[model samples]
Target chain A: QKEVEQDPGPLSVPEGAIVSLNCTYSNSAFQYFMWYRQYSRKGPELLMYTYSSGNKEDGRFTAQVDKSSKYISLFIRDSQPSDSATYLCGKNTGNQFYFGTGTSLTVIP
Target chain B: NAGVTQTPKFRILKIGQSMTLQCTQDMNHNYMYWYRQDPGMGLKLIYYSVGAGITDKGEVPNGYNVSRSTTEDFPLRLELAAPSQTSVYFCASILAGGGIQYFGAGTRLSVL
Candidate 1:
């Protein structure tokens, strides 16, 4: 089984909707969790980062990590069309990074 | 600062062709990695190096090779390219003291 699993979603939502993206992992050793956004033809850019567990808020983006469940989530409040992109969740083992198959989100205006 | 830079933003390779994907980092980081993202699939680590002259393979290393001869450069080599190798590649670097990684603009490669 892959270390990390996420739905490859092309989920479409209307503007001003709340978007939730998640990933589950099997490795408890993962210490760093990250959410990266990638537009077409562009490299993935780090959007939110968190260590271990608990919730972290940054502007309209919030990242939550539940280490006990080996799950992580990214929530976008007041979504906009400019937020349309592929969201990937990554975890670090202190050696290499494991990424989830990205979820493609389209926030239509 | 140019955190990380990858050459040949786009390329098309014929079967059995060999090429190098060049990556350079100006951050003077100690850890560098190469990953490839396939359609509907997550990015898979191809190789990584902790420092100069030290390299290790990740989950998927077949048909690919890598070298870290200098602190600033980590290049990935593909020998006998196959259609299955077509995907977007990214280079990232991180400081050993911190987990945050800086990535380069990806290289889109198509093997026909």
Candidate 2:
């Protein structure tokens, strides 16, 4: 089984909607979680980073990690068209980093 | 800073052809990685290096090789490439002990 699993979603939402992307992991040893955004033909960039299990807020993006369930989520409030991109969940499992298949999101104007 | 930079934005090779994916970073990061992303699939690590002259294989390291001869460059080599080897390649670097990585613009490769 893959270390990290995410909904490969081309989730389309209207502008001003709240978007929620999620990923689940099987490795309990994973202590660091991250969210990366990749535009078309571009490399993935770190968007939100969180360590352990907690909530972190940054502008329109919020990242939550629940170590108990091995689940993590990224919430975007007041979404915009510029926010359309693929969102990948990353886990730092000490030995190496694992990434999800990435959820594709499209915010329509 | 240039962060991570990958050469040859796109390439097409015939089966059995060999090529090198060049990666360079100006951040002087200690950790460098090579990953390939397939459609609808997550990026898979092919190889990685912790420092100069030190390299390790990740989850998928078949028909591929890497060398870290210098602190600024980590290049991945594909020998006798196959059609299945076609994918978008990404190069990323991270600071010592830091999980946050900076990635290059990526190289789209195809094996016909």
Candidate 3:
């Protein structure tokens, strides 16, 4: 199994809707989970970072990790058109880093 | 500060041609990495360096070479480019302890 797995979704949602992105992993050693947002033709930028289990909130974005299920999620509240981008999930286990195929999101007007 | 910068924002190289993708960081970070993004694929590590004069291969390093002679620069060299090597390359740096990586815009390379 791949160390990390994410649905490469072209998820379409209306503005002000809540957007949820998720990832699952088979590697239990992964302790650091990160979410990245990438616009068309640009490199990804870190959106949310979570260490170990639990949740972290930054502005309108929230990241949650459940080590028990090896699942991680990013929640975007009141999404906007500006939030349209590909979301990538990454897991770090010391020296090795693994990333999931990003999910493409489009917030309709 | 530029945080992290990648040069040759875009390039098209013929197969078997050689080229280098340059990456530099002004954050004085010790951990630098090279990653390539393909259509519908997540970023794949090509190479990484912990510090100057130290380098290691990541998951996809077969067609790439890298050297870290200074903390600010970590360039990936493609000796014999292949069509399979065409992708958007990104450079990233982190503060080792925090593990929050900052990425450059990217170098879009096309090997024809």
Candidate 4:
């Protein structure tokens, strides 16, 4: 099984909608989970990261991790057109990093 | 400061041609990595270096070579390019004990 798995979603949502992106991992050893946002033709940038579990919030974005289920999620409170990009979820074992297939999202105006 | 920089923002290569994707970081990071992103596939690791003079293969390392002569630079060399090698390449790095990865602007390569 792949280390990380995510839905390759072209999820379309209206502006101000709540957006939820999720990922699951097979490696129980994975601890640090991260979410990245990538615009077209640009590189992925770190959006949020969580060390073990629980939730971390920054502005309109919140990252949640459940080590027990090996699941990670990113929730956007109020989606915006600027949030239209590919979201990638990943986990790092300090040395090696594994990323998911990414979910493409478009916030309609 | 330029956190991480990749050269040749875009390139086109003929089959069997060779090229190198350059990656440099100014953050003095000890860990550097090379990854390839495909259409529906996420970023796949090609190569990574824990520190200067130490390199290791990641998930996808075929048809590629890498060398880390210094902590500031890590370049990936494609000895013989193929159509399967056409993809967007990204270089990333993080501090020795940090979990966050800083990525370059990326290099888009097309093999014809």
Most accurate candidate by lDDT: 4
Per-residue lDDT for A70 in model 1?
88
User: Model 3, B28: alpha-carbon shift in Å?
Assistant: 0.8
Rate residue B84 of model 4 by lDDT.
98
Question: What's the true lDDT of residue B71 in model 2?
Answer: 94
Evaluate model 2: give its lDDT: 0.93
DockQ of each: 0.74, 0.77, 0.74, 0.81
Q: How big is the positional error of residue B90 in model 3, measured in Å on the Cα after superposition?
A: 0.4
RMSD of 2: 0.9
Q: How much does each candidate deviate from the true structure in C-alpha RMSD?
A: 1.1, 0.9, 1.1, 0.9
How much is B100 displaced in model 2, in angstroms? 1.1
Candidate 2 per-residue C-alpha lDDT over A17-44 given as tens digits, one digit per residue, 9 for 90 to 100: 9999999999686368899999988999
Itemize residue pairs with steric clashes in candidate 2: none
CAPRI-style docking class of model 3 based on DockQ: medium
For model 4 chain A, give the 10-residue run with minimal summed lDDT. Answer: A24-33
* TM-scores for candidates 1 onward, in order: 0.97, 0.98, 0.97, 0.98
Classified by CAPRI criteria, candidate 4 counts as high
Model 2 chain A — which ten-residue stretch has the worst lDDT?
A25-34
Question: Which regions of candidate 2 deviate over 4 angstroms?
Answer: none
Tens-digit lDDT track of model 3 for B2-96: 79999989999999999999999999999999999999889999998889999999989998999999999999999999999989999999979
Residue B97's lDDT within candidate 3 is 42
